[model samples]
Target: MKKLLAALVCSLPLVSALAVDVYDRDPDHTFAFFEFNHLGFSTQRERFDKVDATVTLDLENQVGSVEVSIDVRSISTGSSMFNQILLSDTFFDVEKFPVVTFKSTKLNFGKLDDVVSVEGELTIKGITHPLTLTVTQFKCAMHPMLRKSACGLNATGKLRRSEFNLGRFAPLISDQITLLVSMEALKR
Candidate 1:
């Protein structure tokens, strides 16, 4: 009995160390951008102004998940008239669906125990569809200014706006949208 107790006590630190670490998204540093072709004249990009997320990482077990919420009403297009148009029934329909969300179903990890891609479900306009985000860059380190553990990543994904009921002009304004997520999370 004494030996069993001793062994269990000795492994406490190891168990705790392997536990998942939860991080809250730093809203000030996280944003979601969308890019699409505009009449084939040029590429147009816009971003959501409000994003919130919670991320969990288990480096020892090579598992993690992310849940992100974006305010659809906060779309910024650099033009007030265009922004309002996008908020109308043809685009985001912000009055009906005020938020878009992504919840991870799987986290694909690289050899370095880092997340390489995330398989998730994206919800928009009350419809959900499968989406995968490829992590282009990922880094986890002590934040120089915050003096806290932090993780940051740039991820890209693509989806057809028509699938989410956000397609208005189709090929003319572009139905395909490229998703770019620049996110930073702080350990909690």
Candidate 2:
């Protein structure tokens, strides 16, 4: 533990220096959607309409970080009945766990350009678990309409819903969940 502590202590300066670009999430452009198999017939998709997030990056260092907050009540499935079922105690239990969150712990860079993995802890249904988001597309420039420097990216990841206690139907409904996150942020 001492060596681990020493390593972390030594990395502080690098971390502090790498916080070059700070951004506020663009709600209109950001989306966090998920997919999972429903029974054996087909796949179901849902998304949370309300999400708040902040992202930062150090391009030269190939490092980045993200923090996100998702309003559980905002989860939508197009059908009101399905939405209500998802919010019930057997699923997300939105009344007891009103929010879902993710905060980065580390950044892993790929050898190829525009590819990096964000390691983070995700909390859902009041349970926290580790997750990684692989950035597939990344771009930054001035937004013509808003005239604000902005960055946008799409990331993908997978998780086991059972880990978060959202395994209502279990094997039948499929425990694995896939995530597709598209986020755009403006410089703060």
Candidate 3:
């Protein structure tokens, strides 16, 4: 009985340490930016200010999961009028659809160092599409400033705006939009 009790106590820490909680979205360290071609002349850039997410990370297995949501009305393009036009009926229609979301289903750790591929569902304008994100870097460690475990990930993906019914400025603005996502999550 004494030996069994000792063994159980020794293994308890390992079990607790292996489990990871999904973290809250850290706005300070998170960024969602997108770029599109402007009449084949220059690349137009924009960013969303409000973002929320829940992330689960498994460092040992090299697999991580995330669900991110963004407010369409918060999009900023450096021009108030243009931003308002984007939120109007022809574009995002923020009044009818308030949120755009992405939910991950599978995470594949690639052979390359710290490289991962995530496949998920992206919902925008009431349309759901399967999207894959190629993750370049992923890291988790104790934050020196916050004194809590934190994780960071960077990913890039491209989606056609027309697929989600965002086909307002078709030829004027390129159909393909490049999305860049960078997020840092703190353990809850």
Candidate 4:
């Protein structure tokens, strides 16, 4: 009995080392942005101010999951008129669906333990669609100031606004929208 107890105690560190790590999104550094072409003139970019997410990573298994929630009413378009229009039923319908969400279905990793792409379902205005976000930049290390393990990633994906029933201004405002996500998460 003492031998078994000793063995279990010795294996505790190994078991904990193989466990997954959870991280909480740092609101100050995480943001979700979208850009669309405007009447073939230029691109208009806007961001959601309120976003929250939780990430779990198992480096040993090269598996991870990300779940993000964005407040639709927190749209920032620089102009109050634009923000109001986006929040209305024509676009986001904040009254009916105040939150947008993305839940990961799979996470592809590279040889260096970096995420290559994230296959997930993106929900907007209550409509859910499968979207794959390509990770362009990613880094996981000890934060200089925070003094904790952290990860920062930049990912982008394209989606059609029409698919989500937000196609009020199709060709003129562009139905294709580029979704950009920059997030920093600290170990929990």
Structural similarity to truth (TM-score) of each candidate:
0.93, 0.85, 0.87, 0.92
Cα shift from native, residue 84, model 2 (Å) = 0.8
lDDT (Cα, tens digit) per residue for candidate 1, span 39-127: 99999999998999999999778889999999988899999999999999878888899999999999999999888999999999999
**Residue clash pairs of candidate 1:** none
Clashes by residue pair, model 3? none
Cα-based lDDT at residue 34, candidate 1: 97
Total clashing pairs in model 2: 0
Please identify which of the two predictions, 2 or 3, would achieve the higher lDDT against the true structure.
2
Each candidate: what lDDT?
Answer: 0.94, 0.88, 0.86, 0.94
- Model 1 error, position 53 (Å): 0.6
Which residue ranges in model 1 land beyond 4 Å of their true spot? 2-18
Candidate 1 residue-wise lDDT at 90: 76
Candidate 3 minimal-lDDT segment of 10 residues? 109-118
- Runs of candidate 4 with Cα error greater than 4 angstroms are 1-18
The deviation in Å at residue 12 for candidate 4 is 9.0
**TM-score: which is higher, 2 or 4?**
4
lDDT of 3: 0.86
Candidate order, TM-score descending: 1, 4, 3, 2
